[model samples]
Target: MALDKRFIGREYGPFTYTIGAEKLREFALAVGGARPGAGTPGEPPAHVSPLLYDARAAKAGPYFDLIAFPSFAVVFAVRPFSAAIADPELAVNMLMLVHGEQELEFLDVMRPGDVMTTTGRIENIFDKARMSFLVVSSESRNQTGKTVVKGTWTAVIRGG
Candidate 1:
């Protein structure tokens, strides 16, 4: 069955997340190809920037604090997309769905202790060839209500 076009524009949450320094370091190290172990995020790779893991170095650098890696926004930013996919109303077939594409725009730096709130809505639902496509647009804001990230998420479901 095809996805109902009437579901387009359905809204998802104002999900909230609080950025933590340790998680930031862990994410950077993991993405930078470090091996993690008990109680440590692991030794950061040489190519990784100290501004992402070292508080002291970050404190002296431009942002004056440990800053999250640019892509870390996806952690909190993906909430709404997740919600939409899991929503029973959509009746989406999980096994047939794959993440199609993603685009994120970072408008500001993220730091530890910053709280973020995200909201999104289904932007489009369409069928092409033999597949169905779902697109959702999201925005995340800092505690002060500044837009920190904007995202466009796409999911494609193959015809069974």
Candidate 2:
């Protein structure tokens, strides 16, 4: 089955999510980080930082209490993913599914009390010998139009 390329350059809504401290802790523990708080390089500590009061600075460490791990965003909003794959032209090949690469960019930290929305879509698709590479993107935002997280998800699909 061939993938529908129409999704390319398409955009989805700004899905919503709330960052939680426990989620950050769980992500930290899963990553084998003995350090109290460890996050993506160039990112700040997941533990509460001193810059919590400023709206702009507050986005820095939202992962501590507001975000589960980066993967948590998948759970935070799966509908967009489902919608993309469920499309008739997308060809849902579960057995041939393999995660290729994942890129996460945090625009700001989302605090627990805040609400977030995540929008996702199929970005591009590449054809390989007997498989295909699908690029998907999702953006997480607060109600106030602040981007909490942006993610690029790549999936490798095989032939049944």
Candidate 3:
């Protein structure tokens, strides 16, 4: 069955997530980057390994404190759209779906202990040849009500 085009412009979720220091460090480790959220052992001056080892580097950084890796926004923001695409009423064929593309804009650095609210909307729906495309845009805001990240996720759903 083809996806319902009328579903375009549909909105989903103002989901909330709180960033935790442990999760941030774990994500950094999983992605194999310098431990931006891991604190140096012992005291500051002599014990510090460098900027890479500073857990509070984001705070000490030119950007913000406990800065999150940009990709981390997807952790909180993508869920709403995931729910939307999986909605049975959308009548999407799960096996036919392929991740098309993803674009994310970092408006502000995410910090540990910050609470984020993510909202998702179906931005566009179109078809080309035998494939249908669904484009979803999700924006995440910090507790301060500032947008921190905006992400666009595109999916290609193949038709029989």
Query: TM-score for all predictions?
Result: 0.97, 0.64, 0.81
Question: Model 3, range 12-123, lDDT digits (tens) per residue?
Answer: 8999999987676556544553334346222333433233224666557675455666687889989767977798778778889998899999987776789999999888
Stretches of candidate 3 off by over 4 Å are: 33-53, 56-59
Query: Tens digit of lDDT per residue, candidate 1, span 115-155?
Result: 99999999999999889999999999999999999999999
Reference-based lDDT, each prediction = 0.95, 0.62, 0.76
Better of 1 and 2 by lDDT: 1
* Worst lDDT 10-window in candidate 2: 48-57
In TM-score terms, which candidate is top? Answer: 1
Better of 1 and 2 by TM-score: 1
Residue lDDT tens for model 2, 1-160: 6566666766656555666655554544445333443552223346533333223444555434333444555556555665666565666686768777878786665455667778888888878787777888887777797776777788788872
Runs in model 2 lying further than 4 Å from the true structure: 9-14, 33-74, 77-79
* Model 3 clashing residue pairs (backbone): 58-64, 58-65, 59-65
lDDT, model 3: 0.76
Worst 10 residues of 1 by lDDT: 1-10
Model 2 TM-score (2 dp): 0.64
Ranking by TM-score: 1, 3, 2
User: For model 3, what is the error of residue 107's alpha carbon versus the real structure, in angstroms, after optimal superposition?
Assistant: 0.7
- Number of colliding residue pairs in model 3: 3
Q: Evaluate residue 118 in candidate 2 and report its C-alpha lDDT on the 0 to 100 scale.
A: 81
